[model samples]
Target: MQERNVDIAIIGAGSAGLGAWHAARQHTQSLVLIESGAFGTTCARVGCMPSKLLIAAADVAQQARDAEGFGVKVSGVTVNGPAVMERVKRERDRFVGSVISSMSRIEDEDRILGAAHFEDANTLVVGDHTRIHAKRIVIATGSRPTWPDFLNGAGDRLIINDDIFDWDDLPESVVVFGPGVIGLELGQALHHLGVRVRMFGVGGGIGPLGDPDLRKLADQEFNADFPLDPDANVLRVELEGEQVAVTFHCRDSDTEKTERFDYLLAATGRRPNVDRLELKRTGLALDERSIPRFDRLTMQCRFDDGSLAPIFIAGDANQDLPLLHEASDEGRIAGDNAGRYPDIRAGRRRTPLAVVFSDPQIASAGVSYAELKRRDESLASIAVGEVSFEDQGRASVMRQNRGKLRLYAEHGSGILLGAEMFGPRAEHLGHLLAWAIDQRLTVERLLEMPFYHPVVEEGLRTALRDLNVNLRRGPAITERCLECGPGA
Candidate 1:
């Protein structure tokens, strides 16, 4: 067996792991990265980058179909599903290759192309042969698509999110299970591509975790035309000859119904990839949720003796937040604190921002109103604004005017609490709110800042206008003379 020593070891070369490696390399040269698969896991190859590309193409196809409204009488606008899939694969391959090439450029960086398991507190065994010792270790192993046990035997007819990109031809009809981001995005994309799509889930569309208004808008856009059985749960998948049948149990009624489809795509949630790591040897404690019990701030895993190890956890494995950007930032923070001189503890105040990539994207930042209500009964929050994209000039011009922006503010303090946007350019607008929340900006100050007119950003101005209306009627109103105000 071969042995090596490094200042830090990062497992999983995905977004979070890569970000950690970049941050650690700035401090020391003794950085080692290990991945069971090739560099660039689902995000680079299948998850974020590839999936968004297909969504963009599907958007174009939809827009082309709506060209009649623009006084263009265009016909025979056909969607070549095979061609679109080919382009998606080509683009994904290019991006993945570039990431792999860039990772290879780091000096003295050991890249182990095998699975790694903890041998002890500071030791790792990889590929049944090599042993790696490091001062600090990070577990950033990402997640994989999962299916319920009852639907396991569908065999070749069953497709997960990862397998959809590998399809040579699109199926005539698809029944997608799960109502999360993946299911909604893929269902809409396939529907726009002319595939007869039906979605089934237990909760309402997009689940109960997202914004209600945003979920409503998404349902109007995609679920309105497609059959979305929100109160439906899959019971079994039966394969007969060349056909596959799915049996679903309705939550409203006790009736069981069966439907046949050309393909079944399961977008069920993902679990942490800790099964192969054999974590028992290290004796690191875990929480009731089966996740490693670590300090939320410093991300240091504690031992049975109440001593802390240099090992850290981030991304889906840590279970702080499942968003990609949040995981990347957390990984960077963990690496920075792990490599700190004298090992000073770092305080964690993370404001997670996430965007669900759909036709009308859903993006949110900071705490949700429901979560705040649960935590603090007396927490005062004002829904500063919930305006539609139809009022925005840029959205109308782009012909993507089907969304709303809702901002939350602390009633008394006037501090920006959180923002949820579902419309054109929701991702960009959501980041703007995330910046404001992180900086603790006030509604009045945010409005005072200059924003260009006739742009999509004017939607933010409109939302702030709602806050101004509330502040006018609010008890804390402080009116100043227009002549002597800052405007003078």
Candidate 2:
């Protein structure tokens, strides 16, 4: 094996690793980016980008069907699955090409195509080819979908989200497991595209919703489209001919039912790709999942002595926040700190923001609703403001009004702590709220912002005003705010 020395070594050539490579290069020119798989980032390949492509097509089909609500008659709305897959694959390749193109800017010597494992604290070995003694290492190996062994019996009848984009055409029906972000998005998209989709989960949680009210509202709306039992008691899965058969106790029903489908999609969850890295050789302090315990601000893993180790883990490999943007931010932080070494300074950590692309999109920013419930302080310390989009003017006009929003604030400080929403345009709303939280703005300050008439944002203003009233900093909410639509 050829041996080499480098200032920094970044494992995985995905989004986070790429970010780390860029940031680390600013301090040292000697670095290597190693990968065991394709170069494109997850978002560009099997994740957000391709998923959105499918969602966009589904949305168009849904819009056509919903046109009758606006006195527009739409007779036939057929989804051409082959053509849909073609565009998805074509656009997906374009995205992957762009990422590979950016990677081409790096010197060929800095790139290695093989799996890397730690030989010791300061050494890494890649298969039987290269040995690297890296002064500092960044583990951005990312993550992979995880499911129970029982599901493996499905053989070719089982699939993950990654396999969906490669399908030559849509299947007639699919039985999906896990109602998390991945399951919810793909299941709904397939449902709207006229595919038979039945989703079941062990937990009652719907998407990213921690607020029970929003989850319940989401449950009702999603169930109207297809069978979605967020919490179901599943017995077993077995292979029946070419199809997958599932046995489960239906939600709210004591009777057991067996269902067969073309495929059993496991959108269950993801596990960090750290098990095979031989981290024990580094003698680092690992968490329950074998991930190194690291400081969020410093992004530095700790040794057994609780001192900063040379190893840093970021992105999905850390498994803290799995969003693409968060991974990029963490990668930069880890890379910069690794490069700086002994002169390490804390990096800027952005306010938390997560958005689920399901219908009436789900989003959460800053503190989560579940976090507040764990607080021992008085309930009076936290003030909540809520708005229902069911009657919101713009939402009704768009025929897309079917969700709710909640804002949490400090009672005495009047500062907005966080927010959770299951409403129209939540992607945009989540961003505005995240900015407010980052700026440490108060509810009163938010209410002062302009809300144009007949916009979905008027709903945000209504919630902020409600928050102001709860905080007792402003006059009580009027029965009808003439300036904005009446809760409508």
Candidate 3:
């Protein structure tokens, strides 16, 4: 076997591993980046970029169909399924190509192409030919889509979110399992593209929402145009001829119904890719998931007695927050710390932010209301401000008035804590709130920021005005200021 020694060894050259490579190089030159798969990020290859391209087509179709309200008579909105998939694939490859080109710049000597496993805490074996001994190791192997074993009954009829991007054309019908981000986005896109879609989930989760109200609202909003049972009482799933059949007891009617679909897209969830690494050989404290117990602040795994183990896990491997930004930040931190061993320090973790590109788009920033419950803090200690887009001026103007935004603040201190929203422009709204949370802005202070009129952001001011009232930190908004425009 070829034996190599390095200062640091990073597994998985996805976003996290790439970030680690760049950051770690600052403190050490004797490091290697390892990958066993394609040289593009999941976001570029299958996660975000390709999905957004599909959604863009879906959005165009939806807009063309829904243009009647503006006195624009639109007819014959033909959806060329194969053409849609063609653009999706073409643009997706463009994005993946860019990422791969950048990755190609890394010296071949610094890049090892193989599946590696732990030979010891300080040693890794790559396939059959190479053994690597490193002073520090960073696990950034990312994750893969996972589902329950029962889903296997669909056999060849089953697919995952990853398969959607590779399709030559949209299918006739699909039954989506797991109404999280993937399910919602893909399901709605397929529906808008004139494909029959029925989404089911084990739990009553609409997306990545922590607030129950937003979840319910999202469920209602999405179900308006398609079938979605967040908590499905599915009785059976099996292959019937070329299709998959799903038998379920409908929650609304309590009647057993059987539906056949071309495919069952499992949007279930993802598992960290540490199982094949043989983590048992690491000699570190491992959680039930077999992941080494690592400090989030420093990304350092601990030995059984709580000493640093010279190993770190980041990105989807750590599974703290699966967002790409989080993975990148964690990888940078872990890499920097691994490059400068025993000089570990806490990394900067930004205010929590998550977004789902489902219709009306879903977003949450900072501490969620659900998190407050987990903290065992009294609900009364926090104040909530609510704004319904159903009557917001700009939302009404755009004919997108079908969501709600809820902002939270410390009751006594008036500090803006977090926000959850299921509404138009939530992607933008989420960023503003995350920035406010990161700045530790109070409700009063946020209100001092300028808000341009006749924009969707005016709705933010409306919510903040209500929040100021709840915190009682400032005078109530004048009754005249209650409405920004017609029916606002």
Candidate 4:
């Protein structure tokens, strides 16, 4: 193989790899990026953008159907599945094209369109032609949807996120096997779009939410839209005549349940795409899950010597935080540190933020209620405050009054530790909470801030007020200013 030398080499052309390339370029120009598949990341191609497009179409149909509650009688509401899918694909391709174009800005010589495997700690062999020797390497190879062993019998009947958006026509009914973020979102969207959708999961939780209360609310709401049987252990899957039959044991009720659908969509989760890399040749030992032990603060891989290597892993490949924003942040950290190498600097960790884009969106930031309850040191000091949107003015006006909002704080310090909510516009509320928690803002300080009238944010204020009461920590700024500061 022809050998090439570079200051840095990045694997994967997805968000994380692109991020690393962008940041690493600041430090060195002698670098290369290797990708095996489409240049666009998962989010643009399948995860976020395309799914949101589908969800938006479903939302329009759902809104039209639900318009009667607002004294607006609407008739003849129907969704064209093929048309919706067409639009989603059209827009999705645009997004993917944009990502590819951005990467195309790099010189053609630096971009290798092939799979790469590690030949040694500092060498990577691409396909059969080129071998790259780099001072530092960043592995942002990303992840792929996993198909369980039980699904082997289904063969061509199995569906996955990678190919879901490419369907010419929507299935009449589908069995979503996994109630994770993707499963829940797509299941609900398909249901709204007139597809009979049922979802089952091996975990008790719905979506990615950790807060039990929020999960319960989401469970209720999502179940109303589609059949969601979580904590279900799928036993076997096979073809029954024309449909796919699934046999699963429901953990909650301790019973076996069988269901049939036109097709089976597996949203079970994803596995890091590292197996083909031949990482063992690089002297890096992988854990049971094939993940390299790395420092979260430094993003450096732990070598066989138990010392840090010049290699870094980020994004979904690391499987630490699978969200796009977190992946991008991790990529930057990995790139910065890998470019700096021996002079690596520690990166700041942001407060955790997770959101599931289902109806009455589910969101959480920082220490969730379940997390605090699990920690002995924090449980006693934990306090929860909530506001129901069932009767909230804005929710009622919008005819979307169906969920709740909650804020968690430390009782003694009254600091906003985390928040979990399932309500209309919870995405925005979740972002607000994430920013405040990142700033270490106290509940009292948050209350002192302005809350606009007749807005969804008022619901947030109400929760904070309740939180303040639970903590018994009043506002830092008094309601009265005592005659306008000096001498007004």
Question: In candidate 2, which residue ranges exceed 4 Å CA deviation?
Answer: 472-480, 483-488
lDDT, residue 210, model 3: 75
C-alpha lDDT of residue 226 in model 4 = 72
Global local distance difference test of model 3? 0.90
Q: Candidate 3's residue-wise lDDT over 271-388, tens digit each?
A: 9999999888888899998878999988899988887899988999988999999999999999999998888889989899999888899999999888987775667788889888
- Assess candidate 2 and give its lDDT: 0.90
Score each candidate by Cα lDDT: 0.77, 0.90, 0.90, 0.85
lDDT comparison, 1 vs 2, better candidate: 2
Mind giving the per-residue lDDT tens digits that candidate 2 earns over 79-169?
A: 9999988999999999889989999889999999999999997899997899999999999999999998888978889899999999889
Per-candidate total of colliding backbone pairs: 0, 3, 0, 0
Q: Global lDDT for candidate 1?
A: 0.77
Which wins on lDDT, candidate 2 or candidate 4? Answer: 2
Candidate 1 — worst ten consecutive residues by lDDT sum?
Answer: 479-488
Candidate 3: where is the Cα deviation over 4 Å?
472-474, 477-479, 482-484
Spell out the clash pairs found in candidate 2: 391-488, 392-488, 393-488
lDDT at residue 237 of model 1 (Cα atoms): 86
